[model samples]
Target: MKQLLILGCLFISLGLIGQSEEETEIKNTINSFFSSFHAQDSVGMTSVVSKNVVLQTIGANKQRQQVLRQENFNDLIHAITSIPDSIKFEEKLLDYSIQVDGPMANAWTPYEFWLNNTFSHCGVNSFQLFKQEGQWKIIYLIDTRRREGCANQP
Candidate 1:
């Protein structure tokens, strides 16, 4: 009976190890995407995302009404890569909350957006990913944007 308990514990440990590895892979994929974003490397960004990826944002319009805006993937890539060399911007991720089930995963990241070293806004990004051919690829991404209730604002 003692041996059986030890064996069961071993199996449980192995399962947790596998899950941890998968989580690491998922985090790496996200980090790679952001690295490419900061570098303005379109190809690198595309490599980690599905061809049919969808992007959206939750924000207020000019009249202060909440809206959900869908963005074209190609257009977004163009906008990011078209930034002038003199302009500086970054999305500083504060934390990550990731969950996985089989081949599907979701990552929630809270972030602060900075432009030219000044605070621009704060938000949370939710990413949906699928495992394709043994690699995680982002399938959908949506984020909220707001200027209030952010920590560390000056």
Candidate 2:
């Protein structure tokens, strides 16, 4: 009985170690997504996301009415690379909180957007990812943005 209990604990410990490694990989995937975004490389960005990925933004309009907006992924990608040379943009991520279960993972990141190196907005990005064919890819992403309470990460 003692030996059986010990073996069971050993297996549980190994499983947990593997789970943490998966969490790390998921986080790396998200980080890579941001890296590609900052570079304005649409192809690079697409590599980290699913083909049917859904993107949405939650924010308020000029009248202070809340709005939930969904965007076309491919159009957004095209728009990113088509931005005129006059403006520069960067979305700085503050921190990440990741959770994983089996083949699914969720990453929550707080971020601040800068346009031409000037503060623009701040929000939290929630990414739902799946381990498809042994690699993590973002499938759904929703974020909240507000003009106030932005963090000074510098």
Clashes of each: 0, 0
Off by over 4 Å in 1: none
Q: lDDT of model 2 at residue 99?
A: 89
Error of 1 at 85 (Å): 0.9
lDDT of 2 by residue, 24-70 (tens): 99988988988888788888899999999999999999899989999
Model 1 lDDT tens row, 33-115:
99999999999999999999999999989999999999999999999999998999899999989999999999999999999
Model 2 pairs whose backbones collide: none
Question: What lDDT is reached at residue 10 by model 2?
Answer: 100
Candidate 1: the clashing residue pairs are: none
Residue 76 error, candidate 2, Å: 1.1
For candidate 2, give the lDDT. Answer: 0.91
Q: Cα lDDT of all candidates, in order?
A: 0.95, 0.91
